[model samples]
Target: MKQKLIFFIAIAICFSSCENKEKNQSVILKGSIQNSNDSVLIFYYSDKSDTVFLSGKNDFRFVLDLKMPVYGYFRINKKTINVFLSPGDSLELKADANRLEEITFSGIGADENKCLSQLSEERTKQEINYEEWFSLDEKQFVFKSDSAYKAQLIFLENLQHKFNNLNPFFTKTEKARIFYTYAESRIAYERSQVFSANSKQKLSPAFYSFQKEINLNDSTMVFIPEYQIFLKTYLDKKVYEQEKNYETMNDLIGAEFDIILSEIKQQQIKNYLLHSVFRDHLQFNGLEGAKDLLALYEKHTTNKKNKDEISSLVKKWQQLLPGNSAPEIALQDELGKIHSLKDFKGKYVFIDFWATWCYPCRREIPHLAKLHKEYSGKNIVFISISIDKQKEAWEQMLKIEKMPWLQLHTTPDAKLLQDYQIYSIPRFVLIDKEGKIVNAQAPAPSEKKLRDMLDMAL
Candidate 1:
């Protein structure tokens, strides 16, 4: 009896120690990646992220503090897996890179992960007929999709009930996420039904019966990834239909800002969506319009961190502010003839920084040609500079496309790329006749405003 009492006392002490460690910082993640020799692994919770480089054998161990019941991401190589992280959790994971869908997790945070893994695998199996379903008669499509959604919900319910004993918090949150995910899928199908029913493509009006009542304002549902996407897409579609008279993409985006400000009540999600929209579409239009949208977003958004991020982006963009002298660039033509920006002085230079592999850049060739023709004898020169490493591909495309502009192939030197700060393909820059920058990030030739700006410069 004395020995038994001593053993119990030791066990109690161990439990107490573990509890104290959890209260401090006791998240331990250890894992191995099969078929991977060495790779980088990344994981993150809401505001914190860590990257671990595996040296050999692709084994990893990470210890960090994690807030409980938060959505977290685990990225290995190029594959990403979602996880629910909780404090005091010690998770051991093993995954085969060849068969990524089949993963095994065992430890404190294992039960919920196991359930999620199985559900994903099962859903993939169940969706083997997804291609047929898309081509199915609309009536059959609705019936099958609804049945699948119901099955998913039932499976989620069973999972929550089964895992309730292991981690009630995870079960509750995961179930809610699954439900909202189905809701998002259902809405997407309903929206598609409207399109598919053009002249009655076999879907009865009853196909949309499920969407008659939906809780768009479910604050908690916003946490679901699908709902996050659906909400933004739905808002964009709505704004597109409502704001019929908008001129530029940025103008439509500014109206989207106004719509979100007035309609979206939840400050966090509202600001997040608004900032995302503004940052993406604002620069495609004029700089003054972008500045106006920035001011509008700054005035309305309540997220201070988002405001700071926008401020940083604005500061970065201001590096190409108009009136800044164009960066000095020395590029070579197809025949090994070197040319500098000084050669184009006293002529308005409409420059395209592109690569042979860039599809969008190729698509703009004809438009750039038309602009070149439209502004002939106007003291403006169209300069096409390729960032292609191979001159052969550049020469082949230039021959095939029969581009009339002054085509040059060049590697991106550091100072030129840095001064322009062009991150995306098919970037256009407008230099005034005085050798000063007019619009460092000018509109594309496809955009009518580019012609307007060119005419103004002429």
Candidate 2:
């Protein structure tokens, strides 16, 4: 009896200790930020649902209570510090009074010191290269020997390789180095390739190859200055003429005239291409689209006959904004019930353009479901139209998510996408009772802007 009692007590004690350990293993993130103004420190978990926000202050400290290891950002103004935190580990982030190099966690760690030393060395080398390239006199280069240009090419190549290798190990200083190196190298390469090209085809391929090599998407976050420099250099070289005086020019001019004209046409094409690429980047960053291209079109194109063509593109974009009348859509619901814009005309309607393959759109379904439940009795209709090419995937998502709103799919012809001008998904349009555009390019109802607009409209 005594042995059995002792055994039972031991078991109970072990159970209690296990429970305590489980409770104590929560992830804790603690940090201090200094000299921050209106900066929000946001931490987003990998699971994507959990997020915590901390407001910045003159001397700010915060402790985030989390359940597991996560990756998060500490944003101060426009600058951000990204870190990975594990459970039960205490992290101390100390930002400087000036908000630069304050130090993270403890004293004189070997890895930290090594990183700082390497970053310093890289920055110094990059500064030397920048001075050498930028200080070169363009007039001297006009009559210079090919040897000088060749040497510049060698220097740029070596610097570019060094920057690429150091990029993975980059601190903020190293990031600056990489940006400058890329700018100098790209400018040098563009000058050489453009001046040396024998034909229009060759020039196009060279430019395309250079763009592909730089991999613009990789540089999206930290290469803004470099990108601007590249664009300037490219445009300058694009306008360079083979002959100083076209009146006296003969063989070279005649041979290159067609090529030059073709190049001009190609430039127009490239302008649109680059604008589209930049627009995509802005969208990814959740920024308002740049109107620079529209301004350029208005400035240069003088053909009043093409007004309809231009207006169509602009109108499509306008319809994408908030409170815009949902485009006239025709699709079949889950039960093969035919629905149209007119069917839900009496009430406010949310036409959500989405697809099963879109991760963001998939993540938003639960939020939509909640909204559907909340506004079920109200004179509001939520309709999700999937543009998935495959009906199987659409049906699968509908079943898995158990979405409460009307689910519909268009035929694989993609007519609906074309009609709606939907180049991207997770887009929503809110139509008011009268069907006139209230907010075009409106975000989905899950966002605060949409909610506010809906409240007003209702």
Residue 425 displacement in candidate 2 (angstroms): 0.9
lDDT of 1 by residue, 1-458 (tens): 99999999999999999889767466888888877634777777654688887658778888877655566777655576766657877888889877777778888889878887777666666652534555566667767776877787788778767776657666665555555555555555545544564434644667656555445565555455756776776675667558388777776887788778777888767866787787666434335557677778878787777777767667656766788788787878877888888998889898999988999998888888888888888898889989887778899988888887788876655456656766667899998877788988789999989978877778
TM-score of each model, in listed order: 0.74, 0.40
Best-fitting candidate, scored by lDDT: 1
- Top TM-score: which candidate number? 1
Worst 10 residues of 1 by lDDT: 280-289
lDDT of 2 by residue, 1-458 (tens): 99999999999999999887765555445556666565445554432324344454434444545554444555566565555444444555666536555455532122333344344344444443433443344433222323333444454455546544322323332343354445445466446544543413233333333244443223222223344454435444444544444442232223333333344343333343344333443333222333543454445444443334455666555655555555677779878889887887788877788888898988888778878887789998888888887888888877788887788897545766655566677877677775655654566656877777777878
Q: How many angstroms is residue 259 displaced in model 1 relative to the true structure, after the best TM-score fit?
A: 4.0
Each model's total of backbone clashes = 0, 12
